[model samples]
Target: MRALRRWWHDTAGDLPATFWYLWAGILINRAGAFAMLFLSLYLTEARGASEALAGAVVGAYGAGGAVGVLLGGVLADRWGRRATLLTAHLVTAGLMVALALSRHLLLIAVLSALVGVVHSMPSPAFVASIVDMVPEQRRSRAFNLQFWAFNLGMAVASLLAGVLAEASYLALFLVDAGATLATALVIAWKVPETLRRPARTPRGVPRIGSTARSARRPGLLTALTDRIFLTFVGLTFVLAVLTMQTSTIMPLAMRADGLEPSAYGLVVALGGALIVLGQLFVPRLIDRRRKGFVLATSTGLMAVGFGALAVADELAVYLGAAVIWTVGSMLAAPPNAQINADLAPPELRARYQSVFYLTFPAASFVAPTLGGVSLQYLGSAHWLVVGGLGLLAAVGHLLAGPARERRVAALLRGTRNGRPATSASGPMPAGGPEVATDPVRT
Candidate 1:
């Protein structure tokens, strides 16, 4: 208990204002975003839409997310992180309000797509901001804390949505919109701009772009094309195939077993609770291990969790599967952000994260729809297929092998070299790019 208190105190010290701003946004957004989980139910029960039509609407949302993520990254790089975050929240807030007021299925579908785009807006910029504010050594822990905060928010939101949705569906939309607007206000007022001016080059030196900015240095595109990034994207795509099955198919399985909607919310809350608890300890426990090994182990456990779900019958057994899955997810979450941060040059951090996150939106675009179709066709037994795919993802991550592992390690080492080492850092070594510095202690 004493050690735990000490750790908490140390982690809290000197955190950047940007961290709090981002955290507020996540807490608000997640706490009210439970509407997405129950959207199918809302459409079916309230709008009298068929399951097939509802599922199509959900697919449209996922597709919009893919486009939003790509656009957010470009805008973050061109405009700034603060601008992207505020705009996304405002857009999403308005869409949520529109969704609450509308009854038309087509309009709801369009609004859902718009919301999806805004949903992805804060991602790349926020992630880049975290990397900028925190030191390399503390990044893993910082991301873990951020993940925990979000999950806690999700748990609360799920419970609130479950209770309120039982009374009124429109209430959920109103609450979600309000939270988003609150988050936007926080961002605009509190978060500092982390963007640094690029280093200047000598007059005689050939310039790469319009300005002699070091942050705009070439070779970023080359880094993006590296085999390491490709392998990571491939691995994430497979992971998405497995994870989306949980959101798309698991609820149907529970309903088939006669679980109440409230019980389903409880199940999700249990997972979020586990993530909150696990994030506080797992990073420390695995601190001495190779990140790849940690990733492999966590993904392997997820496969086991899904397998448990495949066979589970009793409510207790199902909840146990949730526990297992949550643990794996908690372990996996911090590394996801850290790996991207490690891979990026300081100048292109936002771009790198944007590109890295693209795999999720891209994979999501297909996985959920496919999983829904499979669930409709295969019934409850489809979970076994999902479990099998998770196992395959674990194997793929493992097979990325020593070469990929070394590349990531090298990048990590380069990041630790203080000044940026990538050619993308600047045109000249003397006046190379500087990473944004802030007081994010963790």
Candidate 2:
């Protein structure tokens, strides 16, 4: 018991107070995250919409989210993290209430998109805040703890959301709104603004007090133009697509093999269950390891797991595959996040994060479509294709390793010297040691 307690402390201790506040807010918000989870059912059962329309409405929400992240990233850099978070959360609460009361399908669709925009707007800011607060050496542990909180909240929501829906779909919206409001309140009360502001420059005169002109804050175009960062983003998207397979294609394949929906649910739940239980130890496992090797190993494990699905017909086989892929996911989460942070220049961090975040929603859309078509045409051979893609992505990470290491090293040196090295975004302002270093108990 003592050993376990010490291990837990080593893993989760020493983050800042504001980070804990953000962490708690995330947990509270996600615990009641029911609106998206059951939106299709709500539309079909309560509002009398067809399946195709429901799907389209959901697609609208995803499209809106894509726009939101980009907007949020710019706002995080411009308006400050706290303000952006507050705006997103408070507006999301209002939209949830509006969504609950609306009856018309078109109104619901429009509201869904609006809700998606406001709800997603905070993501880049939230992550940028973490990068701003946590020191580089301990960031892996901080991110892992954050990921665990998210999964834990999600696990709770999965159990409670169904019950709330059974009672009244309206309750789902109200509860979700209340949770969002609570998170907003938490941020308003506790979390401070984390966006680093540069010395003010006169309009059109370009009179800057600091010599760090890169601090002028570049737009999303900067992230788009960054070749190495774009390479990392592309690989992250591939991993996202591979990860989506467990939720999207795996279920269909299982059903085709005569398995029941309950069996699939149980199998799928295993992955989340594993994450919630074992993710805390992830930082210890990946600590000080080479980022490329860690990512390649993770992708390889997922490849083998998904590849095993080609022959999986029994419950036991499915569970074993779940274990392998879940471990891979656990391994990948922190390093992927840390690498994204490492690659981003501090001045353009939020924009870079926003770009990184685009992968999940993009994968959420593309994976199902591609996986569905491949399953239809390729049969079980689709798993072979998935394995091959996963391996290729793994190799990509390996080949990209040296260049990434050099980039991170240069950024670190610049940070220590109180100015960023000249790179794709040009000379970046000093970013290290800005946040207070006082350790806060978790």
Candidate 3:
């Protein structure tokens, strides 16, 4: 008991107070995150929409999210994190209420998309704030704890959403909106702006230290242009596609094998259980390892797990596969965030994060489409393809290690030297190049 207490203390201790407030806000917000989860059902059951229209509306939401994240990152950099987060949260709450009260199909669809946009806009800001506040040495643990909080909140939401939905779909919307408002209030009351503003010269030019505007202001395109960082983003997209198979293809495969929906639900629940329970321990296990090695190991585990799905027919076999991939997920979460943080310049951190955030929406679209095609054509062989992708990602992470390390070292050196930092590709030249001054609320 004493040892367990010590471990708990060590795992959860030492993060800044503001981070804890942010963490608490995350927990509160996610605990009522139900709109997307039940959107289709609400459309069909309450609004009497056709399945095709419902699906389209959901797709529109996702598309809006893709746009939202990029916009959010830029806003976080320009308007400040506190303002962007507050605006997004409040806007999200308003949209949720508007969605519930909305009756027209077109209006409903538009509201859904708006909700997606506002809700997703905060992601880059949240991650960028974490990176800004937490020191590099403790980031792994900080990210792990943050990830754990996310999963924990999600678990509660899943359970509470069902209960709330039983009362009325209105409850879901109202509760989600209320929770979002709560998050906004928390940020307004507790969280301060974390974005480091560049000092201005007497002539009113933004400059970093003695460099006097050495690097051009990094725009969203900068992240896309950095070859090394782009490589990392691409690999992460592959990982997202692989990870998505659990929700997209796994159940379909199981149903084909004659397992009941209950069994499938149980299997998925088990994976969620493992994550909520086991993720906190992972930082301690992998924090000391090279980021490349940790990522490689994680992808390898995923490869093995998803590959085993090729033969997973029985309940036991399915549970075993869940265990394997869940373990991989535990390993991957912290390092993924850490590396993303490591690669981002302070000026462009949110933009880089937004680019990284794009992977999930992209993967969500790609995975189901590709997985369906693969299952139809390749049958069980689809799992093999999934496994192969995981292995490819693992290999990519390993090969990218040396370059990534050097880039991180360079970034650290530049920061320590108090100069404008360069990105992974190379030195960015002086003065403004295509700097975007237009604003959008995250």
Candidate 4:
């Protein structure tokens, strides 16, 4: 018991109080995250829409999220983290309420898009806030704590989503909106803006290249121009599409097999529940391992999990696949966050996060649009195809392995040699980062 307590303190004891609130706030919101849980089911089962069109609606939501993430990154840099979060929550809350009242297919699609735009705009800013607060050496622990909280909330809400879905689908929408409203108020009361804008250079005056480059706050254009970073983003998109299938395609398959909405909900909730139970220990299990090997292992687990789903007709079979992929998702979560944090220059931290985050929405757009059509025509075999893509993505991770090992070695050497470690994002800032890091723990 004492040893466990000591580990917790070492991992999270020094984080700032603001981060605790951010952690708590997101937990509250995610606990009510029922909208997406039932979105696919609701559209088809309740609204009497065709599977293809339901996928389109879901895809539109993802398309809007991509736009939101891009716009959010710019706003997070140009404005501040607090403002971006508040705007996203408030607008998203209003839209969620409106969505519950509407039944028109076109309007639902449009609202889904708008809700997507407003709903996910806070993502980059939220992640940047964590990067700003946590130290580099311990960021894996920091992200693990945050993700643990998220999965804990999701486990409950996802299960509750099934319950609420069984009762009244509209109730899920209202609960979701209420949670966001409460979250907005909590943030307005507790959280402060963390992003720091760099000083603008005087026009026509030649500035030092290194200094100008250091201070130049990058945006969407600057982020996308990097070829290596784009490769990372593409790789993320592939894995995301495989993971995203549960939200759109898997439930449809289960329903086709005669399972009820609640059955799907309980099955899907296992993913979050497993993460909640195991995320903390999973990081420990992989500690000191090479990042490339860890990523490859994760993708392989997901490939197997999703591939197995092609043959899952029974409840136990579905639940088993959920456990496999959920562990993979948890194993990969912390390293992925650490990688992006390491990738961000102070001037471009939030925007870089936004760029990487593009994969979630990108996967959303691709998974549903393609998975929906494929499931319609190709039938259960579509899961096999999705599984193949997961494997291909795993192969991509392995191919990138040598370069990754070299990079990790160099960083280790630099740290041991009394030089500060650098990243693909370049040298760490001298002392003051984009946000203050003093711990406010009592």
What lDDT is obtained when candidate 2 is compared to the true structure? 0.77
lDDT of 4 by residue, 343-390 (tens): 455666778888998899888888898889999999878988988888
Q: Tell me which of candidates 2 and 4 scores higher on TM-score.
A: 4
Error of 3 at 141 (Å): 1.8
lDDT of 2 at 387: 84
TM-score of every candidate: 0.87, 0.82, 0.82, 0.90
Root-mean-square deviation of Cα positions for candidate 2 versus the true structure, in angstroms: 6.6
> What lDDT score belongs to each candidate, Candidate 1 first?
0.71, 0.77, 0.77, 0.79
Q: Write the per-residue lDDT of candidate 1 for residues 45-112, one digit (tens) a residue.
A: 78997656777777777788888887887778778888898899998888998999999999999988
lDDT of 3 by residue, 1-442 (tens): 9999889777887789999999999988987876566665567568886544655676567667778888999999999888889999999999999988888999987887787688789999999998889887777778888888777777677666656655688888998999999999999999999998866556544344222222443487778767667778888888888876765566557757887545655665676678788988887798678888888889989998999988877889998988998898889998789878877877778888999998876675566556666776788888999999899889888877655755666666666776656665555333222211111100
Error of 1 at 192 (Å): 1.6
Model 3 ranges with Cα > 4 A deviation? 1-9, 38-57, 98-109, 161-174, 201-214, 246-268, 310-318, 372-382, 428-442
- Give the lDDT of residue 85 in candidate 3: 97
TM-score, cand. 2 vs. native: 0.82
Alpha carbon lDDT of residue 149, candidate 3? 79
